[model samples]
Target: MAAILSKIKTEAEGTLRLLWKKIDPNDLKPGDHIYSHRRYGLYSHHGIYVGDGFVIHFIQTETKNNVLRLPKAEKFAHRPPCPKCLYDEYKDLGVVRTCLDCFCCHEEKLHSIRYFVYGAPRVGLLLKKSGTCTTLVSSRTANEVVEEAYELLRSQGFGEYNLCQNNCEHFATFCQTGKKLCTQMSFYHDLEEWVKRRIS
Candidate 1:
């Protein structure tokens, strides 16, 4: 019995060490901005990386806009809906706190980037405002910023999913700097300009 217990403890410790090695503990801090580019490279999504192998982000449920309902006599009428179809019908989307593993593992390949915010040691007492104005700047510790963002996510959630306005990047920027802005929009605009120049 003693030998078996010792082996189990050793295995558990080794497993934990391997898990921690995958994500460097020093690399991730509360309120750090993490983003990943979509497979097509046209857009990216952002999230807040809190400690303990977790990230907070907004998710929008995709409605089945083109669900086909064939006639009763159709050959496929007797076929059952797949598990994904059922999930799409019942899944709820919005601001959610999920494990980092789930966030990274997707069918579409993604490249992730992390951005660190300054003034993570000083605690400032000021409410973050939305938009481009940076008049009321305040410093906050990383933990404090993470707490405030988590509270907002738990209490208020978000308004709606707007690609141009309210998006994942906007949410993450707001969490770190108290300003809502989409960095990808500028990239897209620049790409559009480059295309126009090529055509002209």
Candidate 2:
């Protein structure tokens, strides 16, 4: 069991490095953190070192816009290969470097939506139709959420929206006041619940 876990870790790292090299060969590194240009506060940690300019990292398959449809489904199981994996199999196209960031989407406008939280990191944007909102669960200060929210809204084409954080008697209050952001676990759990609730 221990050996298997270790091997998995090693493989994960190698995969991450290869992915990174394909994206930003010059700036990729193991253990390096990255943020989405569209969503503030959402970040992925635990990059793998593939030496000689390569790194691999994990990214969520779904975001808030695309909530989890099947919660019990295993991650990375039975799913089609990602662009990195595909590129690895066929490197003759020279697609690795250019398609790293966008995964060869070729879409000029790439927007990352903040759809879920897994850990206690207050990173990434929580986007909605009205505007984009930032998580406030990581701060004790009541103003932090508001400040971040304002910044988030402004960044997401809501320049005229006023930022306000209201202390709350309930969950929505936290969002209203930006009082306390939930831990990533809490956010994830709640997000899943929300998905279930909405779908149900």
TM-score winner: 1
Report each candidate's C-alpha RMSD, comma-separated, in the order given.
14.9, 21.0
Put down candidate 1 lDDT per residue, 1-200, tens digits, no spaces: 99977776665554334322334436887776666546644565678888777778766633323233435324332323223222222244566676664455344333444342222211110221121112234355678668867976777566677778788777777777777766467556766999999999
TM-score of each: 0.58, 0.22
Q: Rate the local accuracy (lDDT) of all candidates.
A: 0.56, 0.31
Candidate 1's C-alpha runs over 4 A off are: 1-26, 61-90, 108-113, 116-139, 197-200
Instruction: Give the alpha carbon lDDT tens digit for every residue of 89-188 in model 2.
Output: 2222210211233431212444331222212112223222112223333232324433433343234322221112111111222323434332333455
TM-score of 2: 0.22
Model 2 alpha-carbon miss at residue 200, Å: 19
